[model samples]
Target: MTGYERYLPILLLVGSNIFMTFAWYGHLKYRSAPILTVIVVSWGIAFFEYILMVPANRIGATVYSAPQLKGMQEVITLLVFAGFSTWYLDQPLKWNHWAGFALIIVAAWLIFLE
Candidate 1:
């Protein structure tokens, strides 16, 4: 695969994760908002997540196995979530969080070895 084809899916996944992280957790900041309103807004934001995620997996399939793609997505999610929680939500990740994430990275690495 060309460099663009190889990397585009990862980049797309990253962007999608950003939207997803916001969709799921962005509401935490506005706890007083009606539950129905939060759900609707989160769904609206999730629409964009699907828009990117579907294509990311489709294109990614050309270069990586399904397991690899899923592993990549999981690792990406953690990386993105770590930043989102800390920067956007003002929730700093503790050492154990990093340790768990590191273990997940190891798992992803193992998946890629298959």
Candidate 2:
């Protein structure tokens, strides 16, 4: 595979995670909005997430194992959520959160081991 092809899955994953994170958590900013309204909006956002995520997995499967894809996705999710929580939600991450995330990184490393 070319360099771009090899990295396409990761790029797609990052895009999907951005949409997914916003779909899952962006509604927090509108807490006073009607629950039904937020739910519908979240679903709309999630539709785009699925669009990217499904193709990402399909493309990634050609190069990476299933477990490796899952591990990468989880790590990406955590990283995206961490930034979203901090910048968008104004929630500060504590030391324990960092420690927990570090453990997950270790798990990802193990998953990619030959």
Candidate 3:
């Protein structure tokens, strides 16, 4: 595959994860919002995530295995959520959070091993 094809999925996954992180937790900032309102808005946001995620998996499969994709997905989610937690929600991540994420990153690396 060309370099574009190989890397596009990673980019897509990153974008999708951003949407997903917001969808899942953005509502926390607006606690007074009705639950039904939050759920509907979250679902709307998640629709965009699925749009990117489905194609990402389809294309990433060309160069990466299923386990590798899942590993990457989890790592990406953590990274995105970390930033979102701090920047969007004004919540600081503690040392243990970084340590846990580091361990997950190590696991993701293992998934890439032959």
The list of candidate 1 runs beyond 4 A from truth reads: none
lDDT of 1 by residue, 1-99 (tens): 698779999999999999999999999999999999999999999999999999999999999999999999999999999999999899999999999
Off by over 4 Å in 2: none
Model 3: how far residue 112 lies from native, Å? 0.4
* Candidates, ranked, lDDT: 3, 1, 2
Overlapping backbone residue pairs in candidate 2 total: 0
> Which stretches of candidate 3 lie above 4 Å from their native place?
none
Instruction: Provide the TM-score for each candidate, comma-separated.
Output: 0.97, 0.96, 0.97
The window of 10 residues in a row where model 1 has the poorest summed lDDT is: 1-10
Q: State the TM-score for model 3.
A: 0.97
